[model samples]
Target chain A: MSWESFFQNLSNGISLGGLYALIAIGYSMVYGILRLINFAHGDIFMLGAYIAFYGMLIFSLPWWLSLIVSIILTAFIGILIDKGAYKPLRNAPRISALITAIGVSFFLENLGLVVFGGRPKGFYRPHIFDEIITIKGVRILSLTFYSLVITAIFLVLLFYIVYRTKTGLGMRAVSTDMETARLMGIDVDKIISITFAIGSGLAAVGGVLWAMKYPQINPLMGIFPGLKAFIAAVLGGIGSVGGALLGGFILGIAEIMLVAFMPQLSGYRDAFAFLILILILLVKPTGLLGVEVKEKA
Target chain B: MPFFKADHLVMRFGGLVAVNDFNLELQPGDLVGLIGPNGAGKTTVFNMITGVYRPTSGRIYFQDKDITGKRPDIITALGIARTFQNIRLFTDLSLIENVMVSYHVRLKSNIFEAVFKLPRYMRQENAMYEEAMELLHKVELDHLAEEKAGSLPYGEQRRLEIARALATHPKLLLLDEPAAGMNPNETLQLMDFIKQIRDEFDLTILLIEHDMKVVMGICERIWVLDYGKTIAVGTPSEIQNNPEVIKAYLGEEEYA
Candidate 1:
């Protein structure tokens, strides 16, 4: 491949990796604290895109306002899902919560189909995102630049919240031992709700950016990205946020590079994620950054 | 009125009655010990008071508040803190982080302020970090504040658990087996440490200990349980000399 094409592919890969990291952080965080897989996460991503789409086209809101509204609404829905579906099962077996997560995923998908309809709609990106910047010989989309910058900001903010703040300390404590966290006067349920809100909000951001890149929106649009990001989260380490970020970048760059170099392998691109998942599980079950945390009894 | 009280607390696990109609009262600055043979449901009584397991029947009160079956965090916020039998520290977290977590319930700033790095959040966070360091200093673990709680040796882990609990500014502290794995020398130090904390913090402490030496050395009063029933309650020397307590400890055949 020519140097320019290689640079283009690298930019594309990194941008895609940013989206995966955004989505994967949600998965890793919820898993870290609650030990729940949150299968509905992908559907929440889809809902975000649709909300932004409708906000712009139907409500005629400004792009920024619509994006903000979508994020807030998606975050609210995320908290509602936890309060309704997962909170009741807090003391239930872990398997029960996992199964309920799968059930919640289906419920959201069908809910989307009923509400948003089955047809695919075009996602209208703001004009700024459509501009192409020629950097030396390489052509980079402004959307890719925005995605990378926005993703970096979110990651930094998340790290600060998790490591620097008292709430973050509570989150780490809760993840370590819920009963002990409670004994420390940390409100375990509130921490959990906050976690869901943050995770879902980030997922919404990922979904909106994802729609801009692909320029398509459907009820099922989140399925591929969702699954792929989950694979990235696992490949990095399911319960570690840094691991998820690493996993996302690796998966994204690898996918783009593999497809770019070997056109014939494009058909198996989705399969590649599952293969990575299995290999990571077999090789280092904790993912790259995951410490082996004992499940609370 | 008692500073802390458990009225008719009962705990049952299916067919087994773990603790039966247990009752206790502590005045301010009381240092009491609960002791029993293995499976005597001593920990179960602790569980009920700390809101770990809601009593099958009974109420727990602290500072004249009817705290029966309240959520554990609420109970903790009401100035009760506890350490565990197995040393439940946030093992993966640094010692400072573990103690800092205790300040969470008392934090005035909410998540929005924390996430946005608002001034109130920064002020409170700095205060919390300093207070946590002070707590570590009290436990003599301040030098190792950056180390993971799990990496600390067994005796230090116990002290860290107490430091973490103390960071909540609790008026009442429950310690379950605080000296379980300690040697005699360490146990003596722990007795002094426990008494010092009780006096320094103005705390009413209820302890469960297998170390009779530590209990005899420091506790003002002792409650002995066998098969979930309180067999004796008195000064430490009285507990040692009680016939029923002796039988409970030595077994019926040995007592005979």
Candidate 2:
């Protein structure tokens, strides 16, 4: 491949990685606290896209306002999912919650199919994001730039909430040991709801961005991205946010580069994430950044 | 009014009655101990009081309020805190962060303000930082404030757990096997630390310890449990001499 196309592919890879990282964060955060893999997370991402689509095309709301509204609504849905489904199962065995997650995922997907229909709709990209820009010899879409920028901003905000804030401290405490956290006056339930809210909100952001970049929407569109993001989370270490980001970038870049250099291997692109997942599990079950959290006696 | 009370607290798991008819009363500034062998339901009673497990029957009261079956955090918010039998520190967090997590109960700022670092949030955060540092200093872990909580020695980790508990500004404090793994010297220092904290924080303490020396040295009063029943309650000296307590601990004289 030419140097110019290589840089171009790299930009695409980074932008795609940013999306994967944003979505993977949702998985990582929820798993960190609840130790349940939120299978419905990708469906929530799908919901964000549809909501944004309707908000823009049907309601004709401004792009930024629609995006914000979709994000808030999607985040609310996250809290509702926890309250309605997960909270009741808090004391239930881990396997029960995991199964419930899968059930919720199926429920949401079918719900989407029923509500939005199975037809793929064109996503409305803002004019500003539709423009093509060339820096030196590499051509980059403005949408990709915006996706990278927006992802960065959200990641920063998220890190601040998880690391720098009092609520974040409570979150860390709860994630480490829920019983001990409660003993410290940290409300385990409240922290959990907040986690779902933040994780789902990030998923919504990723969803909206995914729809825009692909310029297409369907009830099942989130499946691939969601699965890929899950693979990314596992690659990063299932419960580590920094690991998710690192995993996301590596996965995205590798997927793009694989197809870029070996055109015949394009058919295996989707399989590539699973391949990485298997390799990580076989070689380093904890992922690259995961640390073994010893059980408290 | 009693500062803390557990009235007829019964905890059952399936067919097992883990803590049956467990009762406790503590006056303000009281330092008490709950002693029993493994699986004797001593920790079960602590678990009930701390809201880890709601009692199958009966109630828990603290500061004259009925806190029975309340959520653990709610119980903590009403001025009760505890340490685990085994260390339960937020291992990934720094020592200061572990202490700071407790202060979150009293945080005034909302999520938005916290995320944005608004002036009000910053002020509260700064104050919280100062207070958490003071707490670490009080526990003598201030010099190692930046270290991961799990990195500390076992004794220091136990102290950090107590410090974390203290940051909740609790009126009633529960220590579950606080000296489980301490040496003679460390256990001696722990006894002093326990008494010092009770006095310093004006705390009413309820402790569960396997170490007879620590219990006898520190507790003003003691309760002995066997087979989920409270067999005796009295001063440490009285408990030490009680034949029932002796039978519970060392078995019958026939066995001896």
Candidate 3:
């Protein structure tokens, strides 16, 4: 009920929303082009955090350098997963592709548990960000400012790529009609591979930033964020980038404000998102920005 | 020698033969027509040629390279391109972007170059845009270049499909029912456009058409089919007078 608590909640919401938007962009981009949910995307984010953790621990690298290495490594893993798990089933039925994605998801999760112990580790925070800044009795961390800046930069770059570049044109083409895209000689498979790599890279950045802000790292950390990002994607209209960002911010603020105002519903935060998803499907199946495609017979 | 040849091409769906032992040879700069009544398998033949469906048995040669059973993308890269009987433009893409997609195979820049905006990538990208614009202009659709393809009028959508197909730089173009939904005036204009492009692009065109006027006016050679088998092949005038063609058109009542 205090104004100080309200301001603190608002800051937390924006930081969480920024991270969600980063992960959701990856989901939306992949779905836009391939119409595949890529269930392994969450595991990719986890892998990113783990990569950054190991890079810093083993090499004693600077934080920025560790972040870059983690992103690149995660992107490579993403492409490998696509080639190994998804490529062989491209010609198969849609259900088969869905199953393959689920299989990949579980494979990554289990693999992480084995490779990186199950115990949660504290992610190291640089000294500069450890210091808290208080503005009018509301406390904030430097990490929050970093999250906002990174999200803004990535979003602008993504928008430019999707709207102004040649490969972006190919992505739009393939998403709209795969058969026609191939007939146009667009190298559909290669474009798809690139899309996966980029999406994975974005997910990695999101994971690292998330772990840094929360100061906790574990194999299961990606699950909650991954699921929340999926919800964000659906809210924004799955295939639209702008929609995902808007959806993430909206969902983030809503969840925080709900808990702040109605303490009794704190336990139902997850259910709230699911209910909104179902309602949207029923009321407007395409979400806020999705275009309805006539199903091919 | 003909630029493209289909020899003894047969396609079947289960027990029903969709195209039975169809043969056609297309010389460079040739404009040919495949005409038949409903269920006559004209579109099926186009599908076979374009690799949408594999023929049950037969050979397809483009510039003397056997392309039978190859995937559609491979076939397209081998200098053969096609449009659907029902227009299949990438509806969500802008009109220019649709054409640029067809030019994708021609792009020589790698992902690194594209992402970094290297000089070579910029050159290739600019050239592609120019080529797409020219193709759009050729189809009189340059003015609508930025509109979503699905938002175009029906006639413009058909033309945009052709423009996209042309961007592939194919030696042979297959048009499946290009005049399917056009009115008489639109159909006549389409006929002229098809002929103009055939000469301009120096292409070999094999079209499936239901519009007799458009077919007779534009095609130098015509093949008539009935029940999935070719019944006649000749010039438009000869086909008009052929007894088998007349029988196929009017059915057994005229013969009786």
Candidate 4:
């Protein structure tokens, strides 16, 4: 392959990876605390995109305003889901929670289909993002640059909150051991709610950015990204924030490059991630950055 | 009134009684020991008092407040904190993180400030880190503050647990087997550390200890349990001479 195509693919991969990383962080954060794979997280992302789309088209809001509104709305929805679905069952057996999560996932997906319709809506990109910029002989879209910038800013803010703040300490405490955390006098439920809200907010931002880049919006759009992001979470180390970003970038680049370099293997791109996941689980069940601990009794 | 009281406490697991009509009272700044042979319900008393398990027929009072059947966290919020029989450190977390987690209850900042990282949040976070470090230093584990909790040596891990519990600023601290599996030297060190902390924190402590040496060394008052019932309650000298306590420890075979 020519270097120009490679660079083009590389730029595209980075942008794609940024979105995946954004979504993956949410998954990792929730999983880190709850130790439950929030199957509905992807639907939350889908809901976010829908919220942003409606905000822009119906409310005639600015892009950034729409993005913020979407994030807040999505976070609220996540809070609602937790209160309505997960809270009642918090003390129940693990399998019951897992099943409830699956049920919630399906419920959200169908709800989206009913409200947004099956037909894919054309995502209306703001004019500012329509321009293409050539950087070092590689043409990159404005949205791609925007995606990278936003991802970096979000990551930095996330890291700062987690590492340098009191709430972050509570969150880490809950993620480490809920019972012991409570004994320490941390409000376990409040910290958990905040964790869900943050995860949902991040997913929402990814959803909006994704819609902007693809110029397509649909109820089902979140499923592929959500699944890929979940895979990215596992690949990077299910509970590690930095690991998710690395995993997302690696997955995105690998998928895109494989399609670009091997035309015949294009159809197998989706399967490749699952296969890699199984191999990783087999070789290192904790993923890339996860530190294994004795399962809590 | 005693600072804490458990009256006629009975705990059963299915058909088996783990603790029967167990009774104890602790005054402020008192260090008490609850001792027993294996499966003698010593830990059960600790568990019951700390709200890990509700007694089948009894009530617990803290500072004259009836706190029976309260959730463990609620009990903790009510100024009771405890460590596990098996060390329950957040193994992957840094030593300071484990201690800071306990201080989460005392933090005034809400989720908004935490997620947004507001100035108030930063101030609170700084204070918590400092407090955690101070507790670690008190336990002489300050140098291990950044190390993962599980990475600490067994003795240090036990010390860290106490530090974490102390971070809650608990009025009553329940330590379950703080010196289990410790070498003699570690046990001696732990005994001294326990006394220092109890005095330093002005804490009322109730501990479940299998190590009679450590238990008899520091506890001002001791309770002996056998077959889920309290057999004796007195000063260490009284417990040492109590006929029931000797029978429980040496068994009827030895007594005969």
Candidate 5:
């Protein structure tokens, strides 16, 4: 009930939302172009965090370099996934690609479980991001500032890429009509691969920041955050990037505020998020920013 | 070297031979027409040449190089571009942006430059913007460059499609039913527009049309298909006089 506690919760909620937004952008971007749900995207997030973890721990690289290295590596991994699992199924029925996505997801999760071991370990907290400051009697975690700053930076870059650039034109065109894009001389596959690269790269940042917030390393750590972010994507009208960000912050604030206002419902936060999604679907069908894209008959 | 050639093309689906041994050749700067009734495999033939469908048996050559089985984008890069039977404008994009998508193939800036908005990216983007607007102007759509393409009137959308295709710097352009839904006034303007672009761009143009007036008026040479076979090829007057072509269009009673 205290204003101080409310502000603290709000801060934490926004930080969490920032991470969710990043991952949701990944989900939305891929879905925007391919209309594929990309169930394996969450696993890619897990892979990213793990990659960064080993980059720092095994290679003894600094956190910054490890972050960059993890992002680049994960991007290629994304392209590899598209080539390996999704590309061949492109001409197949939509359901086939969807099923393969789930399959790829399960494979990665189990791969993580076996290779990384089942036990949870403490996530390495880079010292600089461990600092906490108080503002007007409300405590602020440094990770909050870091996550928000990083998310803001990436979102700006994304806006430029999606709206202001040539490749972005190709992205929108491919999403509109893949065949027409090809006829127009846009390399559909290359655009697709770049989409995965950008989406997966953003997920890498989300994973790193997410680990910093949760401070737990486990094979299945991505499950909850990934699921939550995917919900955010759907809630934000699955194909719109700005919608994802809005959906993320909305979902984040709603969850934190729910638990804050009623401790009794703390365990129900996840359920509440899904509850919001169901309501949006029933009421609007299209997410807040989703335009009804008519399929040509 | 033929500017464009599709030789002995055949496309079969299960028991149906959609296009049987269909062939076409275009000399540089020629405007050709393909006309057939519905299901006559005109569009199917277009698909084979543009890489939308693999011909069961055929050879497609462009600029003397065999381009059969190449992907659509590669074929496009070899200076071929096309519009869809149903307009395929990037509906969400602004009219100018639609044209810019066609320029994607020629853009030299890489992803890093794009994301960072480096001088190189800014330079190319500026150039692309100017060029895209010019293309829109050709279609008389420059004033509405900021509007979503899907929001354009039916006739304007068709014009935008042609403008977008031309932005690819194509040596050969294929338009599938470009005047499909146009009013007679729009169709007349389109005929003139098509002729203008062929001369202005020095392009080889191929079009599939059911509109006999437009086809007969503009096409220097017309090829007709009946039941997936080329039934006639000649000047418009010759095609109109050909007994077989008349029989193909109307039934046996009309020939009597």
Candidate 6:
């Protein structure tokens, strides 16, 4: 492949990886606390994109405001999912919660299908996001830079929240031991809701970035990205935020590079991603950044 | 009024009655011990008192408040904290961070304030950090405060649990089997450690310990349970000489 083409793919990969990382952090945070895979998280991504779309078109809101509204709305939906579907099953078996998560996933998918229609629509963007910039003979979309910067900001913000603050202390405590955390005067339910809210908010923002780059919207858009980002979470170590970021960039770069390097194998990209997930799970079941988080009960 | 009281607390799981008619009363700054043979539901009593389990019947009062069946965290905020029998430290977190989590109950900042690192949030967080480090220092684990809780030696992990418990500024501290697997020498040091903290923190402590020396050596008063029923309650020497206590520990055949 020519160097220019490689750089183009590289830029695409970074921007794509940013979305995956943001989404994967959500997966990691929720999974970190709940120990449930949250099969519907991807659906939240879809819901986020839909929320953004409606905010921009039906309500005629500015892009930033729409983005904010989408994030808040999607976050509430996430909390609602936890309240409606998962809270009742908190004392039930792990498998029961997992099954319910899958149920929620399908429910959101079909809900989107019914409400947003099955046909794909063109994703709208303001001119600022679409403008192009060139650096050293390498042409890159402004969205590429935006995604990278935004993702970095969120990453730093996430780290700060988890490591540096009181709410974060409670969150980490709950993630470690919910019962003990409760004994320490932490409202576990509130913390869990907060976790869902944060996870879904990031997923919503990630969804917007995703749609901006893809320039296409469908009811099912979250499926591939969600599944791949889940794979990234696993690759990084499902519970560790840093692990999710590392796994995301790796998966995105690998996906883009694989397609760019081998045209014939592009069709096998999904299969290849799964293969990577399977291999990583087999080798390090803990993920790259994951320490064995199991409590010594 | 007594600082803490458990009135006829009982716990049943399915057909098995884990604890039955357990009762206790403690004055402020008193050190007490709960003793029992294995499967005697000692931990169940702790669980009920700390709000980990709801009593099948009866009430728990802390400082005249009906704390029975309240959420554990609420009880913690009401000035009660505890350590687990098997060491339930936030093992993934560093020793200092583990202590810091207990301060979460005392933090006045909301999620947004915390997320933004607002000035109010920063002041409280800074105070919490200083206090957490001071707690670690009290336990003499300050040097290893940066180490993960699970990485600590077994005895130190117990110490960390105490430091974490103290961070809540509890009036009553419950320690379940704090020296379960320690060597006699470590157990001796732990007894001193326990007494030091009780005095230092001005805490009323109730500890469950298999180590007789630690329990009998330090506790001013004692309660004994066997087969989920209270066998005796008195001073340590009184407990040591009580015939019922002997029968409970040695079983009926020898006493008979």
Name the runs in model 3 displaced over 4 angstroms. Answer: A1-7, A134-138, B250-256
The B-chain TM-score of model 5 reads 0.96
lDDT of 2 at A32: 88
**Candidates' DockQ values?**
0.84, 0.81, 0.62, 0.62, 0.81, 0.79
Native contacts recovered by model 3: 0.71
Model 5 lDDT tens row, B1-256:
6778889998999999999888888899899999878899999988888888989998999999999989999888889889889988888888988888866778888878887778987888888889989898888999999999989988898999999899989999999999999999999999999999999999999999988888889999999998899998998888888889887873432321
Q: How many backbone clashes does candidate 1 have?
A: 0
lDDT (10s digit) by residue, model 3, range A39-133: 78888999999999988888998888988999899989988998999889777776787789888888888888899988998888777667787
Instruction: Please tell me what DockQ candidate 3 reaches.
Output: 0.62
Better of 1 and 4 by DockQ: 1
TM-score of chain A of 2: 0.98
Model 6 regions lying over 4 Å from their true place: A295-297, B250-256
- How many steric overlaps are in each model, in order? 0, 0, 0, 2, 0, 1
Colliding pairs, model 2:
none
What is the CAPRI rating of model 4's predicted complex? medium
TM-score of each: 0.98, 0.97, 0.93, 0.94, 0.97, 0.96
| TM-score of chain A, model number 6 | 0.97
User: Per-residue lDDT for B1-256 in model 3, tens only?
Assistant: 4588889999889999988999998888888999888999998888788787889999988887888988788888888888888899888788998888865667777656777899999998888898899999999989989998989999999999898888888889999999999999999899989988888998889998887887888999999989889999999888888889888873533221
- Which scores better on lDDT, 3 or 4? 4
Output the TM-score of candidate 4: 0.94
Model 5 residue B85 lDDT score: 93
Please give the RMSD of candidate 6 to the true structure.
2.1
Candidate No. with top DockQ: 1
Minimal lDDT window, size 10, model 4 chain B:
B247-256
Model 6 DockQ, alpha carbons vs. true complex: 0.79
Q: Write the per-residue lDDT of candidate 4 for residues B1-256, one digit (tens) a residue.
A: 7788888999999999999998888889999999888999987787777776788999999998999988777788889989888888888789888888765667777766777768987787788888888889998999878899989888888889988899888989999999998999989988888888888888899898887787788999998899998899999888887878887873443221
RMSD for each of the candidates = 1.7, 2.0, 2.5, 2.3, 1.8, 2.1
Fold similarity of candidate 5's chain A to the true chain A, as a TM-score = 0.97
Q: Looking at model 6 chain A, which ten-residue stretch has the lowest summed lDDT?
A: A288-297
Best by TM-score: 1
Model 2: number of backbone collisions = 0
Error of 1 at B208 (Å): 0.6
